[model samples]
Target: MPLTILTADRDLDDRAADAVPLPHAGADHWRRPYRPGPGRVGAAAVSLLLASFVLLSAVIIVAAGALPAAVICSGVAVLIIALALRFLRVGVWVSAHGLRQVELLRTTTLRWSEVAAVRTVQRPVRWLGLPRTVQGQALVVDRQGGSSLRTLVTDHNGDFLARPEAFERAADVLEAWAAEYRR
Candidate 1:
């Protein structure tokens, strides 16, 4: 169905997951895909470079008769491999029904209606386990849609990844979906 848009105060509070009744955004609401922030995948390359350096160093030290040079080289190799994996581990994606949370360890999806709230907060000097963003950080979307009981999805792992600056994108998609379908 064609949708009509409104400018009412969209005051949607976040809450835990349940078979909650959907809110009424009138007849003008529409459906759209939630776009998440874009992720900059530069770390993988850096990891490879570091690994090469580590190997090169290991070779040089071994030539100089450094004891246990093989062990040191193995350590650098492991570090490089780990960093590369983490780099490949980042991403962002969304759908009409839910958002995809991508991480080094796993990926998850959350539905639209369960999105209780999306708040953009500062990434702090140290967020999750990294440096702060020059621009204010994205947001943490609370949802009861995912399989996991913990419903918070943070951008540290490209949870709402549309463009990194796609806060409005996410909110818009979430609003559109919620307007049309509720939970």
Candidate 2:
């Protein structure tokens, strides 16, 4: 099965925005659009490579008269394809309800009432025990220790460094909306 990112109801989001009192809430909602990012491209390449390897291995196993091995390889190939599809859809979606981080096989959703704070954290890109570069502006959500500091925007989902300005704006919207709704 191909991985599918659930698209929020735009009509509903618009309606919610009207009902809510947050600025830029209606027309300018935050969504992780399928933009061409390095992480996204890399994920595609890795998935393709794994799928190709599985196909070749399966062919070889069948030629060697190992039916069981061939079957296992086919299964692995299916899994690889599914994983790749999911990776393609990885993103964060924000609506009036709250936020949704779409992953390979799961989604983490936080309601507006559940959010305690939104903050930025700095991360380091390290190699051989040294920080060669720093990961700029990771947006985290604090659910008052319930979920600790959950990163809503990061390279893992093709946000943050991938689309810094958009990520920042989304983070601002989230924090402001949460604060307003909490009251």
Candidate 3:
């Protein structure tokens, strides 16, 4: 479904600010809100291009009967694609039900009430974190410090990973949804 952002949540993380306002669900304008899937900077595309070069080179090596070299190059090409996809996992979602934290095989959704706060954490340098998938995105949600729920997020998904600032926009979406539903 298409996710058109109405307004964003401003105080989801601001301790000094008020709580996240909520709008009643099923309102005329109320529909699920999800963030734009991470932008594709063509990194994967570039990776593919490079992998093609490597595989082509492998073919040349094979022609010369350099079986070891060809196999090595072919293997390298496969590795490149795999690593790129790993570094760039896609499917980070946001909706009225809650925000979705995506991963390679499984996905998790954080409901509105369970949503404690959303904020951008500053690090000395950009970290391509994995497992939690906070690598490049700046939007870090403190899932109200759920007793057992671990935070959900994956590293980067192409270009959007580098622009975690988009998370602020993501936060706005959450805030706006809350306002519309004002429950």
Q: Candidate 2: where are CA atoms >4 Å away?
A: 1-36, 103-106, 121-135, 144-147, 155-163, 169-183
Q: Which pairs of residues collide in model 2?
A: none
Which structure is stronger by lDDT: 1 or 2? Answer: 2
- State how far residue 156 of model 1 sits from its true place (Å): 11
- Report the candidate with higher TM-score, 1 versus 3: 3
Residue range 1-183, candidate 1, lDDT tens digits: 422233111223234223353676333333223322223334566677788888888878878888597677869788778867755545444455565555667776656667665555565322333655433454466556533323233444343333343445554554454455444
153-173, model 2: which lDDT tens digit per residue? Answer: 553344334455555556676
After TM-score superposition, the amount by which residue 79's alpha carbon in candidate 1 deviates from its true location, in angstroms, is: 1.4
| Candidate 3 or 2, higher TM-score | 2
> TM-score of each candidate?
0.41, 0.57, 0.46
Error of 1 at 139 (Å): 3.4
Best by TM-score: 2
Model 2 residue 33 CA deviation (Å) reads 5.5
- For candidate 2, the TM-score is 0.57
Over the stretch 1-183, how does candidate 3's per-residue lDDT look in tens digits?
Answer: 423353233333467246444655433332334333334425667888899899999999999999998999999999988866754554445555666665555667767677666544443323333334332334456555655233333234333354456545555665565444334
Name the candidate that leads on lDDT: 2
